[model samples]
Target: MPIDPMLYETQFFGFTPQTCMLRIYIAFQDYLFEVMVAVEKVILKKAGALSAVQVRGSTEAFLRFMKQRFDRLFVKMERALLRLVLSVPPTVLLPEDRSHERHPQSREDFRLLQQDVERLQGRYKAELGARRALLAELEVQKAVRAQLRKTLRWLDGLGDAHGPPGLGEMMSLLIQHSGRLRSITEDVAQKSSGGGME
Candidate 1:
């Protein structure tokens, strides 16, 4: 004898339909935390490697690697996060008890949830924008550092016999540019950490 589909559905999970949806949402949140940790490790590794390398070519390569990794991780993370959010059940308040009229509290709760969802979406977009801007700035810095290294190499080729020109002024300019880059990076970090961008 064939079993009924409803019997299997009811017996397998042993949860009401509404409860199951909530459970799924909770599970997705747990998985997101683990994925986030892995992505953080990747970023840290790339940053450390870029700092240690004095060679312009290697530094550029490291930065490129970081950009690629960030792009891939972000795509996956966004899809998963969006899916979890979209899965949340809509708030519905029905007057199940005939003795009592519909309560205003239900409408208020629904409005609050709607506001929360909008706020979360706004924060997610801001975070994504900040990440993209930071990546672009890092690319620009990489190009500047490569050009500086090339200029230094060319100067080295001009022997001590020629008595190369003083680079004190150039060094100062480079230091200023480096400082600007650091400031931009720190600002991005702060925005991301503070609740402005998730």
Candidate 2:
């Protein structure tokens, strides 16, 4: 059979033993304690009321007494219920999903979590940008080194054909610069290896 929503609604609090009698007893005891305290204060206000001869009250009289005190107690309970309803988390009222999202205790906690996520996203983006720049610089240095080697090869061919006087000096300078570029590229590759994509 389908569940009857009209007969049964959701309850936030759970009770031990889970019996209607226990629920009624707990409700009566809670209100009765407050009512008794209020009655004691009222009796205390009237001088000698406590010291007077205690009379056995009829059931009707006790019921009437409780009826009068319960009015204010009921209003107080209503206000408390309203506050409890308002303070309930929105997640509790919604249908459950299969996502791995954690439920925060309060709005402030949720806001702080959002801020932390945004901070992590920004940090990740910055690291990625730095890595990309390093890779680009490394690639540029490698291309420069290769071009230098190609030019030196062409110079060797010209030297074999009895080229100009300053050609030897130019080849030596180019070789030294090429060696320096190779060292710089090696250093850059080593530094990038930790966080490099390549």
Give lDDT tens digits, candidate 2, residues 123-197.
Answer: 999988998887887776667667667766765775567655486777786786777667756765665564534
Per-residue C-alpha lDDT of model 1 across residues 1-198, encoded as one tens digit per residue: 752233333343354434454465557655655655565566567777554334444545655676577557655765565345423333422334323344345778889989999999999999889888777666666666666566556546644535653588557656756676666566655545443211
How does residue 112 of candidate 2 score in lDDT? 93
lDDT of each: 0.57, 0.59
Error of 1 at 121 (Å): 0.7
For each candidate in turn, the TM-score is 0.31, 0.35
Those runs of model 1 whose alpha carbons end farther than 4 Å from true positions after fitting are 1-105, 160-198
- Lowest summed lDDT across 10 adjacent residues in model 2 is found at 3-12
Clashes of 2: 0
Candidate 1 lowest-lDDT run of ten = 86-95
